[model samples]
Target: MTTTLITGANKGLGRETARRLIAAGHTVYVGSRDPEKGRRTAEELGARHVLVDVTDEDSVAAAAATIAAAHDGVLDVLVNNAGIEGRTADNGIVAPADETVDTLRPLFETNVFGTLRVTHAFLPLLNRSAAPVIVNVASGLASMALITDPEAPAGFYPGIAYPASKTAVNMLTVQYAKAFPNIRVNSVEPGFTKTDLNGNSGVQTVEEGAEIIVRMALLGPDGPTGGFFDAQGPVPW
Candidate 1:
């Protein structure tokens, strides 16, 4: 059976993606930091639960061991969906001028470094699969082409850390795809989906946001790799 793991699968887009993949006959592992929430979500979606805190190395390693033990050391797909927006409670974006190392650190910790940590820990298991796949959940704001275009709405966004971290994720996606020629590694833009990450202010639904993620996670051997895509099609880098 195809086995998959999705980080931050307790709610929002992650949870939705887990549900869809499970329905598609994948043995999905719902990765979450909270054991109770993770177990509950997994039960509701008929998936398994793996406790993981992407920002913590020990936690990520333990989670990897758990999945490997459960699935005979083989993981077909991995969805790095854990992330944070670092927006203030009032939903204020830190201006570029006000951006400091301290201000930017939190976002990078989870969105960038955390992604690397989880992917690194799971590489061995993923490598053992006949058709390994890795999906990095990215953002439209991470697109240099879109954010730099004067006519694009993303160009008007003022946040510095979240966009910068996701841009780093896109880079990671490219490098990983190049490094692992056999694995289909790619980044995806979920569009502006209504989720806690955006304070429910996004324009689309979680179902819509998870479309590209599910599509990429299900890629076959001939599918495209090292690309940034959304539900509509390819997103500019």
Candidate 2:
């Protein structure tokens, strides 16, 4: 059975993805910042639990060490699903430029830098697998072309910090995929889902949001790497 670890699996899209992967027979580790929440979510979903705070190096290392001990140091998939939607009053349009920067800084700490930290820590474990896969959970709003396009979906829901941070994540996915040819790395743009981030305004459900992520996580060795895809297909950079 493939061993997969998903960060921020206590709730939102992360939790939903974990549930789905468990059903598919993968040994999944539910990662969360809080031990109680992590353990509880894992128990609820019948999966293992690991405490992982992506923003902290010590926490991420500890989580990786735990996974190494459990699965004989072979990690099949690492889903960088933990992210934050910074304070965006009025969708951030009315906020000042400095406010945008201030808001985005926190989001980046988790969304962008946090992902790098976790990926770096677990890379050794991932390398042990015959076919390693890393899935970065991005958003359609991250697409510069789509966000800038008048007809694109992201153009309608404008949130500077959340959307821009996801853009960085999408780019990071490509760079990592190129860096690690043996590991199949891909970024997925989940369309607007009714997660806690969007104030539950999205039309899609969390199960729907996690579909692309779970699919990318389960890709075969021959699957496309260094690519960005939405639910339907390829997304413009």
Candidate 3:
């Protein structure tokens, strides 16, 4: 059976993804920063739970160790779905350029460093699986093509820290996929979904947003890797 773990599974796209994967016959670990919330959500979905705070190294390591011990060090899939939008104030006025570094620190710590920390710690367990897969939940905001195009809707948004972190995530996905030829690693843009991340002010629903993530998470051995994709198809970096 496929054993999968999803970060930030307590709510939003992460919870939705976990629900879908469980229906697909995978043993999913609903990973959340809050143990109580994680357990509740996992129980509701009939899945398991793992307490994890992505930004915390020791927490991530412990979660990995727990999963490793229970599953005999074999994790079939990992969804790096945890991320933060930072203090964008509803995507309004851009923060002063001088404050860029300070603002970006926490965002990068969660979106970029957190993903790496989890992926790195879980590599051993993932490597042991017959069919290993890694899905980094990126965003359309991370796309240079979409964000830079004058006519694109993303042009209206003044956020920097969030998108930049996702851009870094895309790069990390590429590098990890290249390094692990035996595993399928890829990034997926879930589109503008109505979730807490955006205060439910998006164009799509959580189901719609989770569609691409679930697709990439369940890719076959022959499926594409090291690519940025959306529900429609490839997204230009």
Candidate 4:
């Protein structure tokens, strides 16, 4: 059975992804910054727990070490799901660019850079698997094409910080795919779903949000890599 580790797995989309993977019979590891929360969530989901703060180098290293030992250096999937929505600036596009930059910086610390940290640390373990897959939990708001479309009412038209961070994640995903052709690396937009990040304003459910992620995680070796997709299909970058 493939072993999958999902960062920020304590709640929201991360928690749902872990639950789904466990139900599929894969050994799932729930990675959270808080041990209590991670352990409890894992216990509830019938999976393992790993304390991982993607923003902290030491924490990320320790998490890799723990997982490597348990899985005997073989990790099939690494889900870069830890991210922040960043604070909102009420003023739409005319909002202070600094506000967006400041808010986005912290999110990137976990979303973009954190992804690199975990991927680099766990690559050896992933390489040991027959089919290694890396799924970056990006969003449709990350798409510059969609965000810049004046004709369409896209989700990207709103938050500057969150969308920009996710865009960076998409680019990072592309780079990872290039760097490791053996590993399938792709970014997926989970669409707007009811979750804590949006205060549950989304029209879709968490199960719907997790569908694309779980699908990407389970892709075969011949599956497309370095692509951006949603539940329905490919999303323009």
Candidate 5:
């Protein structure tokens, strides 16, 4: 069976993606920072639980070890979905002038650095698979082509930290796909989904948000890598 792991799978887009992948016959590992929440969600979804706090080194290592042991050091797919949006406002920046290093550090810690840490930790297991795939959950706001347009809606958002970090994720995705041609890796924008990340103001639902993530996570060896896509199709980087 295809074995897949999704970070931050306890709730929202991650959880929904786990559900869909499980339905697709994948042996899904639901990863979350809290063991209690992770186990509960895994049980509910008939999946396994891996305690993975992407922001922490030890936790990510332990989660990797656990999955490696259970799956014989082979992971077919990995979904990097754990992320944090900076303190948000209704539609625009939250204290645009006050967005500083201190306010934005935590966002990068989880969204960018955390993704690098988790992906690095799981590379061994992923490499063992006959066909490996990595899905980096990104945002529409991260696209320079869209966000730079004065008439574009994504640019109107007042947040900088979240979008900037996701943009970093986009570049990282491209680089990883280039470095590991054997593995299918891509970045996916979930659009504005109704999740805690957006304070539930997103027009779409979690199920809707997880569409591209699941699609990218399950890509075959022939599928495109080093690209960014959304539910509608290719999203400009």
Candidate 6:
């Protein structure tokens, strides 16, 4: 069977993706930091649970070992979905001028470094699969072209840290795809979905947001790699 692992699968887009992948006959592992919540969500979605706090190196390593032991050291797909917005109390993005090293560190810890930690730990297992896939859950805000275009909605976003971290994720996707020619590694834009990350302010639902993620996670060996895509199509770098 196709074995898949999704980080932050306890809720939101991650949970929905796990449910859909399970329904599609994948042996899905719901990766979360909380054991109780993870177990509950996995049970509800008919998936297995793996404890993973992407920001913690020991936690990520342990989770990888656990899944490796359970799945015979083979993981077909990995969805790096864990992230944070780092918005203020009023749900306001941090202004570019106010963005300092201290202000941006936390967001980078989880969204950028955490993604690399998990992907690095699971590389061995993913490599063992006949067709390995890596899906980095990026955002439209990470698009340089979209954010620079005067007419684009993302151009108006005031946040610097969050988008910068996701931009790093897109770079990671590109480098990983180049490093591992056999594995289909790509980043995806979920399209401003309603979730806790935005206090449910997004225009679309979780179902709509997970469309590109699910589509990319199910890519075959011959599928496109090293690209940033959304539900509509390829997103500009």
Model 5, 1-237: lDDT tens digits are 999999999999999999999999999999999999999999999999989999999999999999889889999999999998865455445566878899889999999999999999999999999999999999988999998888989878777788899999999999999999999999998988898876777899998889999998889999999999999899999
Tens digit of lDDT per residue, candidate 3, span 27-102? 9999999989999999999999999999999999999999999999899999999998876565543555735677
Better of 3 and 5 by lDDT: 3
Clashing pairs in 6: none
Window of ten residues with lowest summed lDDT in model 6: 87-96
lDDT scores in order = 0.96, 0.89, 0.92, 0.88, 0.92, 0.95
How far residue 225's Cα lies from its native spot in candidate 2, in Å, is 0.5
- Runs of candidate 1 with Cα error greater than 4 angstroms are none
Is 1 or 3 the stronger prediction by lDDT? 1
Model 3 RMSD in angstroms: 1.4
Superposed on all Cα atoms, the candidates' RMSDs to the truth, in angstroms, are 0.7, 1.6, 1.4, 2.2, 1.4, 0.7
- Largest lDDT belongs to which candidate? 1
Model 6 over residues 45-120: C-alpha lDDT tens digits?
8899999999999999998999899889999999999999998899888898989999899999999999999999
Across 1-237, the per-residue lDDT of candidate 4 in tens digits comes to: 989999999998999999999988889999999999999999999999999999999999999999988888889999999887654454233234456455668878888899889989999999999999999999888888887897755743655667777888898899889989999999999988888776667788989999999999998899999999999999999
Model 2 TM-score, 2 decimals: 0.95
TM-score on alpha carbons, each prediction: 0.99, 0.95, 0.96, 0.93, 0.97, 0.99
Q: Flag clash pairs in model 2.
A: none
Ordered by lDDT, highest first, the candidates read: 1, 6, 3, 5, 2, 4
**Tens digit of lDDT per residue, candidate 2, span 73-141?**
889999999987765465334244455565668889999999999999999999999999999998888
Cα-lDDT of candidate 1:
0.96
lDDT of 6: 0.95
Pairs of residues at least 3 apart in sequence or in different chains that clash in candidate 4: none
3 or 6, greater by lDDT = 6
